[model samples]
Target: MQYIRNFCIIAHIDHGKSTLADRLLERTQTIHSRDRKNQLLDDMELERERGITIKSHAIQMEYKYKGVSYILNLIDTPGHVDFSYEVSRSIYACEGALLVVDAVKSIQAQTVSNLFLAIDRNLTIIPILNKIDLPVANKEKVTYEIMYLIGCTSEEVIYSSAKEGRGIDKILEAIICKIHPPKGNLKAPLQALIFDSFYNTFRGVEAYFKVINGQIRKGDKIKFMSSGKMYTAEEIGNLRLKHISKSIIRSGDVGYIISGIKDTLSIKVGDSFTSVNRPAKAIIAGFKKVNPMVFAGLYPEKTEDYDNLRVSIEKLHLNDASLTFFPESSIFLGSGFRCGFLGMLHLEIIQERLEREYGISVITTIPNVSYKVFLKCSPTDIFLVDNPSDMPDIFNIERLEEPYIKASIITQVNYVGAIMSLCIKKRGMIKNQYYLMPQRVELIFEMPLSEIIFNFYDRLKTISKGYASFDYSPLDYRFSDIVLVKILINHQLVDALSTLEHRSNAFYIGKKMCKKLQKIIPRQQFDISIQATIENKIIARETIKAVRKDVTAKCYGGDISRKRKLLLKQKKGKKKCSLLVK
Candidate 1:
């Protein structure tokens, strides 16, 4: 245990965390040079295409320095805020972290967020400045920023170019010297913390855990602290980019246990595991339950694929504990499931996986944040609504509270004015602002989660010329004057088009929605009216004119009485059609 080192890499998206991990693996010869690939830790194709890590991966490595053999366990984590919960779990399982920052772009929002998480866990941090080989790299400025953020001296920071495999040996030496090994009691009863898990067809649920006390071996009976169910360990192994069987995983070691349990729900991330026969007196302190922040309804494009969609979602949830879903039905879109996600990126990734991996195309409604509604008659009577279609009648509600978030944006100085203006339009209240350096600034705001769910990120990228990065955390719900805006097509309500917006911007939002709908809905035999309404009042209206055919053109040489009679018949038919629409 004294020669074992457990550490994880944390940084912002596109900051080269995976590249650094690959270099370390190469330096340690854990993976052969002939089988090298870009972003080896990011196994998913979507992750490579998007240039970001989605899932956390752990690998065990053997390194020899100064004729001393050591065991190094490294975990590579996602850098996006949507997967911060996953990063937190990875951090809790490690003894230290490597803080990677870009030499050109300096520190980003997620970089700061991850640093805070590492500090909160009381883990040792090793700061590394990457991408120093770039032509535009600003090493001095970036080193200063890292020093300011982490309170470290210039000599303490390591410089490297991960793409070119520079300074990898120095990083390995630092890890061996700086990072402390895991320490636990070997005489106590068995206790382990399950950080992650995935399903396997051949064996069952494979649980990735760190032994906190005692030891685990094959044929040992273990019980989950939360589920209170017992299962025999079919296998015990360590990860070397692949599962390698081991006879025993002693205390202060990380390994996987193949418990002969078919149900994936029985094994949860952040659950504790202990010996069934000689149980530990107390379970290890695990992380809090993960709660999804964004909600949306996913419907199959074809009704016959409903069962396929359900199966696909179940398979997805087995690997991802942050995702939640339940059965939901819509009058316009048919039967579907109401799904919850960590954020917008999580929702997009799930949708893409369902289509690509499961071969099931789906239609997704507008995404929304959960809202708390209080009844007028009883102040204590409160309920949560995840879908606008399930919202209560407008007349029965007393007050509405929506979720808010504390957002941090880091960008160049020139784009500060534009970002501030955009935040004001989105009803964001500025909380603080300071200069990270003379050329860069950090702006903090408290805004509604619903406001940024649709187009805030895209607009921020556009206005900032793709140099700005953002991170946010959920704040408590606050009472606001919010209303549900409904869209009507020829006097019939379309529940899929409904949205919740602040009362002050109802007119502007409604007008824009009506104009957009007018262009999408096709013309019919009768004039179709698109109306945006709040309660009983219509705020915006657009009319799609009926298809006009010249009936009088065919009767050019006819009598005047004949033409008049034909025109009278057409007018009567038009009046009847209009009455039917009303």
Candidate 2:
């Protein structure tokens, strides 16, 4: 335990967290020279193809410092905001964190957010300024920014390019000298924290955890404190490039346990483990499950594929424990799932993986955020709603509450005005504003989650010329005047196209939806009337003209009697082809 160092890398997107992890692995000689690769911990093919990390990977390294051998348990966390909860899980299991900042882009929104998380956990922070090898690196300014943010002296800042492996020695030395070793009582009852988990077809479920107090060995009967399910440890080992079976894992050490538990929900992230005979008295502190902010319905493209999609989704859930979903049947989409995701990007990644990894095709509806609705008859009862079609009628709804988030955005001072205007247009209120540096400013806003889940990030980047960095965390629910906007074709409502919107912007959004449907709906033998409605009143409408043939022009000038007969016949046929909503 004295030689163990558990730490994770924290940073904003594309800030060299994974690169730094690779350098650390190489410096420790954890991998063979021929196995050298970029983002080695990011084993998912999707991650390599997209050049972004979607999952957190944990690995163990053996390092020799001076005359002592050290066990370094390194967690390479995803830098994207959508996976921030994973960062929290990683931080909770570690004694220290490496705060990596890019030299060119100083400090961004997620960088500050992750820093606060580490500080809250009372973890020792090591500030690392990466990307120093680039000619355009602004090393001095970023160093000062890191120093100010961390309240650290200039000497404490480690200056090294992860790409060039310049500061690998300094980082390892800092971890050994500055970060405190894990403190645990080996004699205490067995208490382990499952920080991360995944499903395996050949070997049931694998739980990667940190032993908090007691030791665990092969063939020990362990039980999940949360689920109360007992299982024999089929295999116990340390997490190296591969699972290396160890006879036992001692306290303050990170390792993996392969139990025969096949059920996905039985093994949960943040769950506690203990010996069945001597269970811990209480669960780990601050063990709340992740709250998903974005919701969407995923229906199998073919009805017959429902069962196969179910298995695929279960495996995916085991891989991404943050994803929450339940079986639901939709009038428009049939039997499907209403899934909750961390954000829009997370939603997209899940969709792409479903196609590429599982070969399952699905139909996704308009995304929405969960809402708390109260009925007039039962005002105290809160009906949780994530689908717009699930919302109760206006007459029955006493109040509607929407989820709001505190969005942190950092950008240059010149783009502040445009950003403020755009956020205001989305019903965002300025909570605070300040300048991080002379020309770089940071703005904090309280905005509805639904407003920003779609295109807010893209628009912010466009307006800021790619200088703005955005991150958000959920806030409390607030009451708002929200209405259900329904889309109809030929007076028939399409539940898949329905959405819950604030009354102020309902009409405008409805108008846009009508125009979009007009362009998308193909022209038939008769005109199609696309309508956006609230209750029975239509707020917007558009029409797609019928594919008509000029009967009179085709007749040419053969005879007046023939032309008249043709025109009369065409008029009668037009009357027979009924006009929608006369």
What would the per-residue lDDT of candidate 1 be over residues 191-292, giving only the tens digit for each residue? 999888877778878889999889998999989988899999989999887789998998878999897778767887888999988899787774757888
Off by over 4 Å in 2: 549-557, 561-582
**Which residue pairs collide in model 2, if any?**
none
Q: How does model 2 score by TM-score?
A: 0.96
* Best by the TM-score measure: 2
Clash pairs detected, candidate 1: none
lDDT of 2 by residue, 1-582 (tens): 989999999999899988999999999999999999999999989899877778888999999999899999999998889988889999999999999999998899999999999999999999999999999999899898888788999999999899999999999999999899998989998999998888888888899999999989899999998888899988999999988999999999999999877887798888899998788898887865789999999999999999988988888888788889899887768999989999998999999989998899999989999999999998888979999988888888899999999999999999999999999999999999987789888899999998997789999999999999999988999999888999988877889899998899899999999999898888977778899998668999999887887787876567799988887887777667765334
Cα error, candidate 1, residue 578 (Å): 8.3
TM-score of 1: 0.94
Clashes of each: 0, 0
What lDDT score goes with residue 290 in model 2? 89
